[model samples]
Target: MSADIVFSDATRLAELIRTRQVSPVEVVQAHLDRIAAVDPKVNAIVTIAEGALSAAKEAEAAIMAGRELGPLHGVPFTAKDSIDTAGVMTQRGSPIFKGRVPDTDATSVARMKKAGGILLAKTNLPEFSYWIESDNLLSGRSNNPWDLDRTPGGSSGGESAAIAAGMSPLGLGTDLAISIRGPAAQTGIVSLKATHGRVPMTGIWPRAPRRFWHVGPMARSIRDLALAFSQLAGPDGLDAFATSAVPFDAGVGTVPDRKLKVGWMVGPGFGPIDTEVAATVKAAAEALKNEGHHVEEVHIPALERDFALDVFNKLHVMEMKPAFREATAGHEDQMYTMAKTMLSLPDTSMEDYIAAEQAAERLRDGYATYFRDYDVLLTPVLPVPAHKHGITELVVNGETVDLTYLQGATVPLNVTGLPGLSMRFGTSREGMPINVQLVGRWQAETTILHAAAVLEGVSTVRGRHPSI
Candidate 1:
């Protein structure tokens, strides 16, 4: 029974608690037990909240006293170590800020707490949440739950691993490039990278490159992602970028399902994708077509791999490094390798920075044009399935490519400030999960979610779990 409790998703767990079939205490304790038994092998969870069990007991008492409960009244969730949680340790997977604790929660964290979600713990990330793999001196690297030797996909890798292994039902993760979608894809979970400023980033670190950073939910179920997104979106007033008041249509709650125009790509245009990963995306498109949606292979312009990385690097290198340099001034030797290398790179010329920004605008224009005709664009979340930890290069579709190409499909959406969701679509030959990304126009999460819901119902990978 405890095993069953731990494996349930947040939506189902909330229903069980609301119906009195299970108490809040049972739900929290079950996951705590699962973490104890399984987390040693994965190392996904970095810090367990000191007050979780006590809070769960209080939730149980309130329910027994006939008090009304919020949507996630008793369900436990985790946040990436980079996100703020008042009074809880948020070491950010780096030794520079070890023992750090914030006095106030991030806007997203506070909103989740207000909606009755419990913060069970903080999960791991790359040092300062920067690299493509989750590892740092503060907490060792996090291994994938499906294959212990492979990576879970970083910056949000730990959150993805915990959700996949049943240690947490839902989680909050931030994405700059591929953090949320890529990690969720590698682990066979569902996650969203909402439109820029859709969710606040009031208390997150490395606040430069402010225009590109996003915080959203990563969960085992698409409905849970939608639920959590609705709770976290809207202007928090503290974050200057969160000035818009857009709400997720959710495409649920009595809206009848209808056909959607989906453009699916296995690219020679974006980057080289493994043959198997391409097939999985095509299969997902066929499933969508069978459901009466208009699915087709569409060509998009300005998707050069060079342009994507150039724009990201121009802003990331110039803007994101100085803050870290300032933060770790006295403790240079303690910095992680990737971060140390990032700070040591030669300065960018002003002319190059301007050129990259122009290229970014073209990339945005290309997506804007494509989205006008198609409701959503479908692509593989990563070029291949999770790769072994510390392995740098990959042979993708017969070409030896730099691992940075993993974000080929994802980073473009971030550059455009468009919304994208990554969900489990198929399984690899090794029995590992494969995911595909669905990109939608600005503030069109509902359209993407509705379309994904249709395909998800017919996907063979749904509800499958890692043996971990």
Candidate 2:
């Protein structure tokens, strides 16, 4: 009963509660119990929401009273500590902000609650939500459920770990570069990083580089991603960037009338990728072709000319350092590795900064040109599967590369402000999860979500979860 409750996706859980086959209180309690059982091993949870059970009881009362319920009513969802949650400790994974509680929930959190989701808990993250691993002085590091020694992958790592370990059925995670999708890939879960401004980053921290930042849902199923995106999309009136009046449909498995053109690539632009990971990308392309879509291997020349990672570093370092300087001022003692690293890096020269801005435009233009002909693009989410915690370097295909190269395949979407979804399609020889990325044009989330659901239907790894 506990396994069934904990592993069920948000969509299924909502159905069960709505039908009264399972009480809201029971659903919430089962998750709380699962957290108590596994969080110590995973360290995914930083602070449990004290009001969670009470909220569940209230949801139960509404059902008993025949009151209308929200779509997620009774379903429990977690948010990364970086995302503000009213009355919950959102410490931002640093001692400088320890014990701090926001007076209001982030737009993302409030919307999840508005749809009937219960606030389950706050999960761990890197300091100031920077870096590629979940470790920080505040809540410590999060370990992969698949292999406790391997990291879950960063800033949003704890959110990914919680869902992977059955501690949370759904979660909200922020992405700047690889944070959201990369962690989902590492954990064998599914997460969406919608177009830059599609989902507002209103209440997440480190808004200095807001252009590349995004907030999206992480879940065990592709349908949950679609459902959460439908609820979370549109302008909130506060975030100027989120002023898109675009219409979104939770169009899971909606087959298109014409054959969708998909291009898959693992190299030349994204740097070296593991052979196994590369093979997984090919397999996904093959599966799509088998399903009768127009599939072919293709590359964008823009990516080759202006490497997205280099552009991001040049732009973000200039934009982000000021925020770090402000936050860590006089509290340098509490600063973590990522904060210190950011401070140590030299500022981008005025000439380099302007060049990076132009390069960013080029990258965006590159994707725009490709999307003109192709409806979807497929690529590896990470060069390799989850690696041992604290690894500062990785050897991909015999060439030693900086650990940041793991962001190689993911940062392009951030630079281009394009929508991308991460879902597991294969497993490494070491049994770690390998996920493929599905990308679409700006404001074309419906297309990628549709593609994701179709690919999910044929995934050999569908329904697989960590033994933990």
Best by lDDT: 2
Q: Model 1 misses residue 7 by how many Å?
A: 1.3
Kindly list the per-residue Cα lDDT of model 1 for residues 83-137, writing each as its tens digit: 9999999888878889999999999999888878889999999998888999999
Q: List candidate 1 stretches off by more than 4 Å.
A: 249-258
Runs with alpha carbons beyond 4 Å of true place in candidate 2: 252-255
User: What would you estimate as the lDDT of candidate 2?
Assistant: 0.93
Clashes of each: 0, 1
- Give the alpha-carbon lDDT of every model: 0.88, 0.93
The sequence of per-residue lDDT tens digits that candidate 2 reaches over residues 335-379 is 888899999999899999999999999999999999899999999
